[model samples]
Target: MTENDKPAEAHEQDGTQLARENWERYQYCVSRGHRDYTRLASRLEGFYLGGGEQWSREDLEILHEQGRPAYEFNEVMPAINAAVGYQIHNRMDIAFRPRGGDATKELAEVRTKVAKQIADNCRLHWKETEVFGDGMIQQRGFFDVRMGYDDAVLGELSISVLDPLDVMPDPDAKSYDPKDWADVTVSKWLTLDEIEGQYGKDARLRAEGARALGDEDFGEGDDDGTSRNKFGWQDTGRYDAEYAGGGPRRLRVIDRQKRVLSQMQVAIFPGGDVRQLAGDEKPEVLEQLRANGAFITRRMMKRVRWIVSTCDALLHDTWSPYDRFTVVPFFPYFRRGKTRGMVDNAVGPQEALNKAVSQYVHIINTTANSGWAVEQDSLTNMTTEQLEEFGASTGLVVEYATGKRPPQKIQPNQVPAGVDRIIDRAAGTLKEVTVPDAMRGTQGPETSGIAIQSKQFAAQQGLAVPLDNLARTRAMVADWIDYAITKYYDSERVFRITKTDPLSGKEVEEELTINQWVPESGGYLNDMTSGEYDVVVTEQPMQVTFENGQFQQAMEMRGAGVRVPDSVVIRHSNLTDKHEIIQQMEAASATPPDPLAEAEAVLAQARARLAEAQAERARAEAVNKSIEGMFSSAQTATLVAQNPAIATAADGMWKSAGGIDKDAAPAIPSIDAPAVAPPEQNTNPLTPANPSVGMNAGIEGGQP
Candidate 1:
């Protein structure tokens, strides 16, 4: 058939229409983003980099005409950098935890190691810092994660930070997360060779043809002024010499990911997830499933699909392997479906500060010295320039016209009373609206150490939103890496994991292999694909200053008898060779003891035993003495009480010795005396004696 006689296929037409629609959609998104975010983000980034023009164009032009310097002291940069450095120094670590049965615990550990390995291999920290800086300066940041291949044999997960300008999400979407947006488009300029290498020769040819077409709608080879203005491009002659000036054409490649819900015929495996089936394969798969008595069903499900296209051609179209888009976004201050950033808060005050400073300098420059007030053309001996230049020189003579009054010296006006105060106020406001002095590591006005620490802590707390957003982004990225591992590392693969050994204070490298099927267990050991996992992000401060503080605190605790181990204290130190030091300490401990020291130790033990024996003997002696004292007191009491009995036995001897001292003795009562009971007497000792008791009984009348 002739070249024009062949009919266009329906599939080609559909692809072309889809490509056009996608291009249109991308254009609309770009337009909206430029209006809503990109322009402002560009300005904010300028502020961060110290390039944001504080004065208006007209004002700047007037200042330039007047030979006045438009000064800009970048307060925004210091605040933003302080915040970014805070995150970098106090880095966050990603950890994986088993969310399924206990069987998944080991696998989750392996996943954690693998995740860390991925982050290390990809330099995720640096990228994270860039993303964080962008988010703080602008309103959002993005992380793109995907699997890359090494030597086309081994797969590795890669993470990179995406420039906010390169990413365009659905502006009308009611969420700030890119994954939750209805669609997200990432654009980049690629050379033809790069295009061929990535998308294939057909794509390169199509892109080349589109560039040759030079259609503005195709977004290729067309340098609309928007790119230059939005990105603040200078006259670099790149477009004149390279792009449309006969050099190689660079095409803008768009990767658009969209979420869609569709109805599909799916085969439901026994106790498994449903798998979608194509129209042509549905009947055969159904028959096979029916033969096996498997379940079948139809359902509507949401799926993410990626479409790669240029302006005029579709390069690739496939369903995303991940559950969500690969690009994750972090918006620090999202409210009402929009975003605000630290720079936004500081811009007003920063501009004011700059203006105040600039005006102060300008006033000083203009009024630092006295000027001469003279009539027009009053100088006679010298020109105005020469006269003014030599006026400040010593021993210079000034000659004015004889008719004109001699030039009068006009003193400059004093600077306004509150000019310094205005500058200080503006500067303070800038700091207050953004990072505080405490956050910048500056000493505050508080005299108490505790007050200073509390102020610093409060300042850090002020950044909780951004820091928490960063942690959330990290957790999300961890999940992405985990999913990627499960999808890509489904074969026996060996990788090394490095970790700090807590006991030895050294980094230990371990080589692990996963996904090896075992017939005995009927499953793969360390299988990442088998179970669900949860991601947790924890802060691990990497700054030496923080480590030093921790070390000092640990030492103080140890001094206070807190029982903190020496090895742990050393681990908190910032010494680069602390592990070596620990090793040396351990070696010293393990060495054989000195003979003399051993002998001394033995003698010390013997002395302790002897002291204990002596203590025991002393206690026994004390108990015996106590018993003897009690017996002696009892014996004395018995001897004293027996005096009455002894006196009764010696009655005859006493009578002979005293000659019966009967005259001095009182009359005794006889046995024949009246048996009358003695009258009741008062028992109280203090009462008067009852002298009538014995006389009334009449017992004293008869003596024995």
Candidate 2:
């Protein structure tokens, strides 16, 4: 046989054998992984919902056989609920960051906004939280990202959480990302009309025929516990006797997805232009490309493909447009090549707590009140029956033989002190194993806010791995969404998202479009298909607290004269009207200052300076006048000393005006000149302080 003919012969194999092989592999996978995990996960979910022992009929029977009541004192629910609540309380958002060229950065912003709008439209937060809660309770969670047209020309991106039991991944594969798995199978129960609507009438007819073949030929589904928990009792019988038309005829439709090797041709031209051909080109197309100076090269790659089949027939086969598996699996606590949940450790203690509390209640019920021990001869108006009925009544009168010792009271049986302690310890152990008191917001009355915050932070740190796992999964989902955007959104489309603007702190509707034609570049602007983005998950467990702290810090900086921007301060504030407030601030900034007011302020300052200068000048002139008078007196004294007649006349004038009194004041120096005078007799106030001073000293000192 020729090598190329082998695939044709393989494809010619009987449909029944192919179906058998696929179904058997699916069964094998279910046996090895899905079935056992489903059972455990279901029980864990029961425990989380306060019904842990509800389906354990054998255990309840055993307890009843032992004369104990069957009860479920659910201490597990609180811890699990608290853990789930913690995720809900601290909401997170997914962001896309550019990892390529400058164009990628611009596209990333538009994509980020588009992603947020998609998330809001699909209510992604609720789905994410649901998946997280399931993972915490059941050890695994899944998300499905896909494009849906919904009867429109343009496709929309959607994300949904899938039930863990409904998805069967490769049992031996150990990877956090689903794209790395060897294969995965997803099963759904759909009515014939539903299947026909999705896969066409021909496919639906074949699936219906397969359903009629019974377990011997088509094989029975191993979905006893799993499907019942999720889909609730799917009737897989050939025909429903209770219904007139077989009750819509539901069938198990399995989509087995895997990657297959494929080849693509890359054509390189002389002008450095390259194009990829998907190996389906005609001879003429290749010859034309060769004539255009193109070098053709082939490269082998793996591409995602999935098959739709029932137990007896292969319905369809197709390749996925997206780069990887659409379903993303998140294992919060993957260890030792296996995935386990936070609830795993707490399950044992939780059961013990339930049993302990149940047993304690039984003890109280059986031994709470005491019975009487009475003398037989002691009889009054009351018989033994009456005494049994009324003996415990208050103010009861019992007439007995006078000396018959009063009926003695029997001691009541007490529940053992250790039972209470056991229940408490089991409950505490359950909490410790799962969430702990700190995470549950338990604290002493005297606990300071700082101390409480510290404890809460420590508790959060303990669960950081799981939170990180969730974040990583979200990043993968974001990447998938980005891929869908590039692949499906080839035309300009508006994405209207309602969000709180980071700058304004207000809920506003934002619209953005991608792949719009740009005449300047002669190509599309914001070409989403041409760039790469890295997904960054922004967790906001304390968004309010963070924003409040930022706002306070900004205000303080402004108070300290730090020139902080009003826009920045407004952005961090929590006011609902911040958009309006910001708008006012921007408008005020854009408006010009009043020129007349500025001039008036400058003039006021100038006038104050002028008054100060005038006052300074007047003080200087008064001092100058006093100094001139002193200098004139000294000059006159110098002239008088040169002529004795003037000195004698001045002395007479001084004496006549009573300028000098010998008894009260020292005698003034005489104007009459002497060749030399005694120093003690020199009483003139204007005399040079230093005998050797220069004659021009006064003039020089008074020059300015």
Candidate 3:
């Protein structure tokens, strides 16, 4: 059968009218985005880089001639963007607060660990979102966070931020002030790839690819099986030649434009959450699970991708990918004096100031260049061509000497009065809208302490609305991270766990099974899923810590008479990462010092001293007994013969009294006392006092 005779099936999409219908809807969303962002992108870039089409032609010429202008003194918008960006980048703190049944401490801690790990990994990504979002929040006045899971492809969960310009809600929408999207949020991005990758290698994608080829040039030669008319016009490739602009054309009329649209619509159902339901009420709610569906379509040029997918969201069981994800929309400086994000607060003042500065620069250059009119008399020597050259190069005009005039300055609005004033006034307006002068470090010395503080507070207050939103964003991101890990990161991961090792107290890194950390599971991390969780975006208060950190703080508190544990101190110290070691230190410090143990230590020393004293006493006693036996006779004689002052009666047998004191005392033994005559009576017969050298030794060490 001929190509047309083969019916619609011979073409692409396998005859599905549904795909075509979806393509039409996607086209509308994409067109809306293009319309909204067409001017916005260029405007934001103009502010950032200092040029835009909105500037007058003269201004553009000046800028084009000058390249980038030095007149972009309006750093206020950037300063605001930077100030908010820095805060979010450095201090977008968050915590995983569990809700519903899984809110126990065990689960909370597990989720916290999971959240921390995820945060550590995705912190940069989140900040990047904030940084770009800050610009949008400052420029367009709103931004959003889009979360997804493709770990099999991305290695971990992903949070792809949708650029504010691409976030198309509704064309008639006055503001991005929806409290919640009871319906849907559509995101559109243009891809330059000729092949639609989202559809894998499907027939529909192949069809779009074929359409994008632009021309069908199958060989006109007879051998290639393509026919050529007498006029030499060749038929388009494989498909039937009956159609115009190539047969089986896949792209739609709107898609014909070079930009292809990748449209993702997250349609949240009204009742995806049933946590509040009674136990018996759950079964009925599950029946409506299909209501929480998400649709992603890849439209290539005029054609629609065949493989459009719709799935039940694991997150919130809604049309959202973030059952665990959060959309932390930032509108730190929302207008309307309300909490919702509005069009750029600085848009008006900023654009005004940019124009004023550019013009001021141009005027200043003009005044400096053409201020003096050249004397025509001086140019008389030069030709017309030479004078023209001089005029063009110097921006000066030639004047005839009219009785002449010397070269004089030409003053436009010679008063020049309002020029500076206008420029200064514009600058002031821009500055007023921004917070670099207050919330940041640029406070002037003349600014009083109270004023400075007030400014800071005002700056903080200004951010309050967005901060609140960011907090929600953080909580959602954190919750989603936990959810992602629980659901996706099931493999063994050596998670850093902080706790005391029962035996030693000090900070340390210990690994806990991811599954065990999560409250409900005693299994591996893979075994667990974040069944349900709640997230809380919090600005973790910057603790006033000394250079010594938590450790120093702990020491100071201790010095101040406040008892604090080393581990607790470590938590505040540089050893925060070593939580386990700190915990161990805390555990060890908690045990009370043992009084009985101290007593035992003292008793052991006392016993050693007593043993030494006994040995000395024994030696003294043995020596005294031996001396009495040896010196009895001579001592007795000496005691009897000497006067009482010089000699007293000796008690030992070896130290008896002199002169027969033995007879008076009932015959103490005296063998050979030299008779009391002359030199011999000096008791030479008495042996030296005996000392029992071996006595103490024998008593102590069994010496002979």
Candidate 4:
């Protein structure tokens, strides 16, 4: 046969064989991975619901299990919840370590912008991963990352998380990063409408699907869990024909060529064909699809999809230009333990503690709430119904009976005293193992705030395990995202993100375009021209240290009576709008104090009073002088009246007074003065006898 013809024949054979083998592998993986896991699922479900799965008929069959309330006294939920108790979610920071050396100023800016874009994407997808991580802790052993195009984003690139339960791996894989793998598939339940919305009416396989679907020729799917396991993921759907009708989801199998995912194919369950069909295609086109990952459906079987078009070429499978798939599993030791037949390998002592607490809680509650049967004297109680009614009612009522003896009451046996201690210890241990006490805000109000903060810091340090794992997982996804951005973002595009302003150290919006990062700017592409670069991953910067440390410093400064800038204090606080706050503080400080006019007014009042007092004394002295003059004038007038010359003499005296004549003293009755005793010899410094040589000499002689 001709070379082209030989490939066509080989293609048909590959299609049939691949379908059978894949269906078998799917069944095997279910048996090994997810089927036996119903028990684990039950435990995880109970942990969240606060008790084991509701008591079933199977549970009721055993006399010991009846009347148990699934009262889920939960300690597991708290531990799992606290494990990721971060005030901030996006704690990761990315820096590109260029091979040659440091980058230029412009190049550094570009790299920083690039890091922020990736970080923004991580932040967008991170919350979901945390949720999945909780599940991974509870039941699912691990979670995964899927990087793809997001139309909602400006850059069109985004990241996503995958539940571990949604994925099925090759049954015989030895390691996480195996040298080779046959295949891995991810499945999800979707409604008919969603399928129609995504794949559309055009997705109908045409006449070929009608001819091939449920055809006896292709062979049946492996329905058994042993020979060929077919348990596909957590079904999530009620399999109801009505609401939430997305049952039996089409699983997407990522088939590999050598090591990388070269194509994508859909799986078909063992059921009648419900797929719409299209017009026939040439045998040559059909043959070409068989060689690739394409398949036709059969009842309880797998299928290779082919397109019927004018051009003799395969479609869809090759549309994904990303030669490598973006899905990467985060199971740290998935490959290692699975080989050793360890299911739920990630379950540690913490899980055991969690289960023990759950069991003990059930026992205690059941003992008190349900197991305890009330009893009374059969004659006094009379009817069983009446006794039940009395037991159920919360209100207390009593009926006095004179004839019969008072009814006797009997209570059920009490649980051991040690049960409370055991329960308390288990809860404490769970907190210790998964989440620390400090992280949960369980530290009492009486605890010192600083001491509590220290405990929190220590607890954060202890959480290094999961945090580190998170960093590592996110870093891997980031590497792929970086690669995708480099390859797919050929055209210049702007990605706007909120970034921390370098100088201000505050968040501000920024935009980075493709040209800003690639060859145009001296960034990854520019650096690559010189030498390759490495992706260095770091957990999101711990602002706790910056925040709490600054806060403590501020508080101490306040205690020390130091003048701390209001803006500086606010920076360490929970307040927002630092720039606005700083501006307000600056304005307040810039404003001058109100002038001290009141003090000036008081001083002015005292000066005015002194001036008024001086004026009053002057007026009184003038009045006294007037009175003296008037008295002298009256005496002169009386004498002048007796002698005609008196009036003339007064005028003369006024004239003489200017010339040297003085007015005679107006006399009153004079009394004889007692002679002063001779002054005793005095030692007054001012009146020293020998003035020149004594203490008062300097005053008299200037210097003796």
* Top of the candidates by TM-score: 1
Instruction: Quote the lDDT for 128 in model 4.
Output: 40
Per-residue lDDT over 127-217 for candidate 1, one digit per residue giving the tens place of the 0 to 100 score = 8888988889889899988877754475788788887767777878877556568988887776678788887897777676663323322
User: Which candidate do you rate higher for TM-score, 1 or 2?
Assistant: 1
For residues 140-197, what per-residue lDDT tens digits would candidate 4 score against the true structure?
3333333344454424555555554545555566555422344555433333344445
Position 634, candidate 3: lDDT? 53
Write candidate 2's Cα lDDT for 352-436 as tens digits.
8777888888877655335677788898788989887777677878788888877777776778898899888987887777887
TM-score, each model?
Answer: 0.79, 0.76, 0.52, 0.58
Q: Give the TM-score of candidate 2.
A: 0.76
Supply candidate 1's per-residue lDDT for 320. Answer: 66
Worst 10 residues of 4 by lDDT: 306-315
Q: Judged by lDDT against the true structure, how good is candidate 1?
A: 0.72
What lDDT does candidate 1 reach at residue 445? 58
